[model samples]
Target: MSATASFLARRAAQKERVRILYRRALKDTLNWAVHRHLFYEDADRLRERFEANKHVEDLETVERMIADGEATYNKWRHPDPYIVPWAPGGTKFTRNPTPPSGIFIEKERKI
Candidate 1:
């Protein structure tokens, strides 16, 4: 292969390796009982809340549920933002409105 082609191939291989590592780490973390417990608890709570209000056939209620789910997902995904040093009323750095595409590493994956 030409030099450029060889370099590109190597880069592709490295990217694949990184992706594999990311998937493995995520699987391992989620396999833990604590992770499973928290996930199921949050999921069950959300489901119960939705079911309790299922009889309310109003647009506003549906919208509220959607918003609540999104907020919960965000909080669970980024618990650190709500934790120390960035507690309530503290100077908080908002996330990028549109995160750049490609290989975005989550905080948990780094641990």
Candidate 2:
């Protein structure tokens, strides 16, 4: 690939990585907010923070910002992340047995 093409590819990948990081951070924030209203405010703040960097044109600065953001996320991550009751990582799912209570499977009949 030409130099310009390679740089563009790397930049695209960096953007994608930043996008994924932002999503994970947003979800993690839910673990810290007890009420839905509080969560909306937290989510808005998070969106603003990410949007503030949307106009950045310097690749190096973007990389630095992403690294800093990731570091901050790691530093403040919830010790006990809140998982939805039906989610794989949550207690309701992890501690429950397979098939659950009301699920039914009808056997296929051979024609």
Candidate 3:
């Protein structure tokens, strides 16, 4: 195989591994949350961290952290408000520029 093909294949495999780790971590987080409220308290922080670091190329390293017991779901909550999400792959958080108007807003406003 050409070097480019090899690189692409490796990248694909890496991404798949990352996805697996992500799913496992998500499952662990959910399980922990179900068992105790501490995990629930950290949900937002965990989501933010995962969203931030989700696209790192060295997925194995991150996976190791998740598997190593150091990345417990509760670790998401520490000091002050919370840790910021990393915005993985250099993606920015795009807020909705404008709110939806008219009927939907009016109907909800009644409650």
Among these predictions, the greatest lDDT belongs to 2
Q: Work out how many backbone clashes candidate 2 has.
A: 0
Question: What's the C-alpha lDDT at position 108 in model 2?
Answer: 100
Model 3 alpha-carbon miss at residue 46, Å: 2.9
Tens-digit per-residue lDDT, 3-50, candidate 2: 899889879989998999999999998989999899999999999999
Question: Where does candidate 1 clash, by residue pair?
Answer: none
Report, for every candidate in turn, its global Cα lDDT versus the true structure. 0.51, 0.90, 0.56
Cα lDDT tens digits for candidate 3, 1-111: 698797778778766765665565565556545455766665666577668766666645755755553445346522333223444322343433356565344454655
Off by over 4 Å in 2: 94-111
Candidate 1 per-residue lDDT, tens place, 27-88, comes to 43343326667756655654565457546544455446555654654444433332333455
Candidate 3: global Cα-lDDT?
0.56
lDDT of 2: 0.90
Candidate numbers sorted by lDDT from highest down: 2, 3, 1
The TM-score values for the models, in the order shown, are 0.31, 0.78, 0.41
